[model samples]
Target: MENANVLIVFVSAILLFCIAFSRLITKAGIPVLVFFIFAGMIMGSEGAGGIYFDNASAASSIGNFALCYIIFAGGMATSWKSAREVLLPGALLSTAGVMITAILVGVAAHFLLGLTLMQGLLLGSVVSCTDAASVFSILRSNNMNLKAPLAPLLELESSSNDPAAYMLTITIISLMKSDGGGFFGYALMFVMQLAVGAGLGFAFGFAGALLINRIRLNSDGLYPVVAATIASFVFAAVQLMRGNGLLGVYIAAMVMGNVKLVHKTSLVRFFDGFSWLMQILVFVTLGLLVFPSQLRAVWLPALVMSAALMFLIRPAAVFITLSGFKYPLKAKLFVSWVGLRGASSIVFATYALTEGIQNADTIFNMVFFISLTSVIIQGSMLTPVASMLGQLDKEDKTLVSRSFTDYEEDIQGTLYELRVVRGSKAVGMAVSDMKFPESVRIMLIKRGESTIAPTGKTLIKEGDTLMVTTGKTEALLALKERLALV
Candidate 1:
């Protein structure tokens, strides 16, 4: 009981400190996640706090649990309408681009770090994907608005590319354990994981949406609980079937996000906050798992590898994979620069340590350094780089803000007040009966200074001033037509 209490207090302190410190450093242009990691390191056994924690299996379990929700939240937040425009490019970037980057990094690691081919490949695979959390944090935090399609492309690629890197890592581990045999068998396994994960994801997503919309739970809060349960089941079932659970969870989320469900606003908000908690936990846990002294031995090699990844391998992969597309050179260059490896890479590295692979310690340390460097350097420079490349959108609108289902709130679109004229068609009609477009929302209504919190059943009245908000000009125009104000 004493130990448990101490544990709780320690964790709460770290969380509170990280939260407060992150806000203070936002203007410094450093990624807030870097502080979460530093807090863990500062509290580790080697640092001032003297809390000893060195269990790889525990870290791996916690990291996987956190990553599952992080991926799910990302999927739920994605807008299908926006994603559709860049699907093909995103697909190629996530798959072929990952493969190219991994292979190049693997070759470089073999030559530069004196590791065997398979071991080098394993190292490469661990850092292959651009982290969704890191990319989303940087883009959203900077209030970045890239030209059309580029922002969506980057989001889709980061969110969906994890499976490829994961499969490659697992496959390489299997080969190393089996003395580099069974190449064909592992390739077949890789393909099967993706196919099964994708199929089951779509099936579960639609079913979950239908259940949420029809169940009509007694409490609004229960709706988010149900959605979380469905996500858990989807991930567990896919993993049990030998499919990639991360891919399954993400696909399921994307499906549910696009479909209509009850209490969607609350659902999105719940997962958004929950995902942040998970990220903090994952980064801090990873930070606690490492020893700063051990990193010294691998620092030079890790630095070399980080440089190669940031400058050469990532750009090559982006350009090679995106060559056929009609994107501007500046856009492609910006995309390549925004390839920030973060929590996901560090989490993936824990897999190697748990599996007891050769040089696991070295691999883990190198990956940690690489991820830290990427986030600090690339993450901080995203805004300036985009501006230099001429990719920043001058318009106030941002792709990150509009990427969610509840985008009107994020966009903070124009608000209009129009008094209901006597005998207007909208008069005496319920707000629900107005049939406002999904993009438009009635904020409130005022009649004779008696403010009304408008509900679906709230009736419009003569001389009532309606406060309306919407992000879409077309939706606003349509609402005007419906109210006979145009």
Candidate 2:
């Protein structure tokens, strides 16, 4: 009981500190994830806190669960309209680009670390995927709005490429274990994983959306619960069928996100916050699993591999895979530099460790070092690099400017606060009865201590605070004057 209490207190304290410290870190132009991991390291056994934790299996489990939501949230937040523009290129980067990167990094590792082809490939595959959390964090933190398709391209690639890297990692591990699978067998497995995952993802996503819209639950809060359940179920079901669960979750989210559903704005907000919490949990847990002291042994090789990945391997993959596309040289170079390996790599490395592969500890240490350095270096330089490449979209402010839902038209407007005063004609009237301007939207209603999503039938009581949005400044002024008359 005492131990459990201590554990609770420690975990909560760390979360509080991270939450409080995040704003400052973001302002400093550092990746918040780096700070989350560093916090875990500070509280580890070798650090001042002396909390001993070395559970690879546990870390893997937590990481997988966190990644499911993170990916789903990312997919939900993505705009299919924007994503479709870069679909072909993004697909190549997520699939062929990942494979090429893994192969190149594998070859480099084979030479640099004196490892076998398979072992080197295993290490390469572990860190192959560009982390969604890291990319999203850095881009959003820096408020970077890349020019045209670059932002969507990078976002799509990072969120979707994990399944490919995961497939590679698992395949390499199985081949190492059995020494049996030929090239044909490996290719077949990879194809099957993607096909099954994509098929089931589309099926479940549409089905889930239909179910949510048709089944009108009593409480608004339960909508997000249903969505959460669907996200987890899709992942588990896909994995059960030997498909790529991560891919399934992401595709499922994208499908559902595009479809109209209940309380979508609230649901998006909920999942967005939940995914951030998950990222913190995953990073901290993985941080606790590592001993910083062990990293020294693999530091040199890790540094070399990290440099190769950033400069040679990632660039080659981007340039080669994107050769058929019409992207400019600056765009390709920027994409290459933005490839920041992060929590996902360490999570995949944990899987390798749990499987008891040869030199698993060394692989984990090397991956940890590589991920840390990649995030710190590439993450910090993202804004400057984008600026230098002339890719920054100065006109756009939001990371995701497009709407993900069918109902929310034009999310890029100015928000206004309006209060319902006593004796106002609008009081005791339903929101639908107001006949507000078409360009205006009632986003939220704050009544006393409770906030409400104002539906058409919702009554506008006196003393209610309405959070509204207008597409133009003139529309906002018109709304206020009209509200005063009401």
- Residue pairs with backbone overlap in model 1: none
Residue range 1-486, candidate 1, lDDT tens digits? 998898778878977887887755555556788898888898899986688999999999999899889889988888888888999999999999999988999999999889998889999999999988888777766666678878889999998899889889888888898965688999999999999999999999999999998996678889989999998999999999999999999999999888776676778889999999899899999999999999999999999999999999999999999999999999999999989898888988998999999999999999999999998888878888899999987753434555433322243688888678866789899988988887777876777846665656677888889888877888787677767752
TM-score of each: 0.85, 0.84
* Residue pairs of candidate 2 with colliding backbone atoms: none
Residue 295 lDDT in candidate 2: 91
Candidate whose lDDT is highest: 1
Q: Estimate every model's Cα lDDT from 0 to 1.
A: 0.86, 0.85
Q: What lDDT does model 2 reach?
A: 0.85
Candidate 1's displacement at residue 51, Å, is 1.5
Angstrom error at residue 320, model 1 = 0.5
